[model samples]
Target: MGVVNVTQSQPVASMPEEDRKLSFREKVAATIGNMTGTMHNQIIATFLLFFYTDILEISPAYVAGLFLVARIIDAILVPVFGVFVDKVSTPWGKYVPYFAILGVPIAIFGWLTFTDFGLGANGNVIYVTATYLVYSILISIKYAPSNAVGPAITKRIDDRISMGQIGYIAIMLGALFASLAFQPLYKALGNGNDARGFSLIMGLVGLVGILVSIFQVTSLKERYINPNNSQKTPLKEMISAVFTNRSAVVLYIYVLALNLSNGIRTAIMIHYFKYFFNNEGLVVIYGAVSILPTFLGVMVSGPITRRFGIKINVLAASVVNVICMLSVMVIPDTKAGIIIFMALNAITAFFLGASTPAQGSMMPAAMDYTEWKTGKNVNGLMGSIQGFVQTLAMALAGSIAAWALHVVGYVPGVEQSSETIFGLKLLMGVLPAFVLLFTASILWFDISEEKQKQITKELAERRQQKS
Candidate 1:
């Protein structure tokens, strides 16, 4: 018994040397799964409003309402689902089960959202509201759980960071496809009718997304702590833990700022393309340029996290973003000038992509901090608050964008006023830059990598003793 205890005590000299480094196949599978999941965001953030307003002819005010109301509903669902994820046990894993159950339905509803059926403006609004709300809820089901899985898959901070980078790469690829391909596909299929063409493209992409998620669930393994045997705490206790847990609160606030900034940029994209650029087709060009940096940044995220720490990386990215965004105010909006500005924005996105992995690493650290301090793994509720805050940010961003457009005298189907164009430019550039700067302040987190390893080592010993 003494020898066994000693053997267990020192499983390895240091972190077991990661005997099961992710193989190429596993990395590819993980990337595909992550990319599929991100289709939800890219589609929502980049395309949905434009699809409704310009293609379906829905009112901008109504579009804003749909975004706000649907997110509210989805936010309500997050805590409930988090509780469900905590209590449930499955063959695949707690988080993977959601992908199995919700992935198909999410895809189906997404398909319905794009189909349109040639409904008039009012009818289209009603159809879109119902389908989009359902889609949003379904997305919450998969997203909340999958996010928790990141920590569950690995105890090593470095491995988790690597996984996060792979996931970000996948997400960037999805964004790239959505931005670059959707418009061209719509043009080919709809023959100049954007509404029908875009719908068809979304339906096809939805099918692909479902398959990717399914494959992800089947291929991946959850090898770290099992939620089933982990310590359980009540919701109130978990909520309290989040406040006391400094890392958790900082991460929550940081995510809120990032989402708010990104959401503002997404909400105003159509207006910028149509009014400021004087061409709707420019949406594709901007989208491609903006997303390209994500691909470039993902390659270096692991090394950056290793060298500079997560908070510093995030701060550096935010600084770069602010500088690039402020340039828009100085640079004239000529074709060449716009392209140059877009290129600079893309560079900012590269750093933004690098920061995402850092953010992901922080969540698990927060979970560990809670467990280490309270002896309870309240990942589900912790994840719920994270989701809720992020969704709230999105809702606020959408409302702000809608109100900004209204204040600037934006009127659909008419040539936009110069004031409206100015508003769009601000929304595209300055607003997001300022929001990111503020969020960077919130990322004054204290969870260094070495400290995180100590927590994990202690937690593993505790688990072994109980066993």
Candidate 2:
């Protein structure tokens, strides 16, 4: 075992040897698989709270509490799933075997959440809560494995960067498709019953999620498994590793802030458009206008990260986002003003979206640091811990948004006071801007490109000697 090689700078991508480069097919398959996971997330984040509040007539407080409960359950379970992944090995692969087992359950539970099932208000809450827990647990089980694959697939930093870029592009595309399809699907299927529409849409999306998940499982190739290491990491040790790894800890805090902000923004957008603007249809238009620039962001993220370094790229993008969001907040609420503001928001999303790949690529490097320091490869633990933190942040945001809505005297399907409108504006703009500014400032990762290169070279040497 060697000492941990943590450094105090962002790691830039370096060209891998010829043998280490991933095939185009492999990259596509991973991207598609990642897209499926993100699609599920997009649906839940962007629409779930709105569905419960608006269509089902659930109080925002109840729904927010439900979110809180589910996330807490998930946060507790995340590390257990990580340990399980580390201990398990099978014919399929160490990381992906659970994918096949969890696929059907994930799909079934995901679709169930949107259904009414003739349950009364109290009964519906119970049903929704139970179903959400199941779906969240399944996601916990599956996401760590999928995320851990980048490190398992290759030791090459550039390959990891490439994979992260492709994976985030998949995420953007999935969110894009959801945004584009949601209004149309709800309109066509629900007619007057939006509840039914949402259920059917989720059903279709869930099935696609299952198929693409399976596709991702089959397509991925895990090349860096430690053959001699079959022992499961103890819970205590996993906890120790989490705090001990400075890079991982910093990332946890960073992602928590980012996701919390996103959760608030997404949970309130429909409300902002529907109640505040008095034009619910504008939600669709906003989604449509935002997609092009967001797509452009995903397209260019790889080149930008490679050239300017991930930390610089993310910092610059986030600074621009802060300005854009503040601009939106100050703009008057006219049709043209809103359109222009949405366009600017689109640019903000572009910069924000561009930061994702760089953020993701950092985790594998963190895992490398953990292993180099502790003599144990805890990639699953690292990934799941991040997932756990993100879930917690999202829960915090959801609950806060819900309570804020209540405090502002928001009533579903009714006219709101000026106070309510002001709160909605804060959720959409100022709150998120402040949180994002914090996100940019704290992204000073402690792993330089040079240090990462050294870590990788040493890890390879260690593995070779073991083999």
Count: clashes, candidate 2: 1
Candidate 2 TM-score versus the reference: 0.83
Pairs that collide in candidate 2 are: 7-446
- Which candidate ranks first by lDDT, i.e. highest? 2
Write the residue-wise lDDT of candidate 1 on 1-467 in tens digits. Answer: 01122223454233442235665555555556667767767777778888888778889999888877877788788878876676666866766666668878888888888777877766887898888899888887665676677666567777777777887877777766766676688889999877778778878888887777778777777655556544345666656766788878877877888889888887887777777666777766766676657866877898888798877887888788788877766667578876786788788878988888777778888887776776656677777778788778977898888898888788987887777777778878888888877776545688788778777777766665655
Model 2 lDDT-worst window of ten: 10-19
lDDT of 2 by residue, 143-246 (tens): 67766777777766667667777787787677777666777887799888888988888889878867766776777787767843426556677668667888
Error of 2 at 376 (Å): 1.1
* Clash count list over all predictions: 0, 1
Residue 342, model 2: Cα distance from true site in angstroms: 2.1
Model 2 ranges off by over 4 Å: 1-19, 44-68, 111-132, 182-207, 227-232, 271-280, 406-424, 441-443
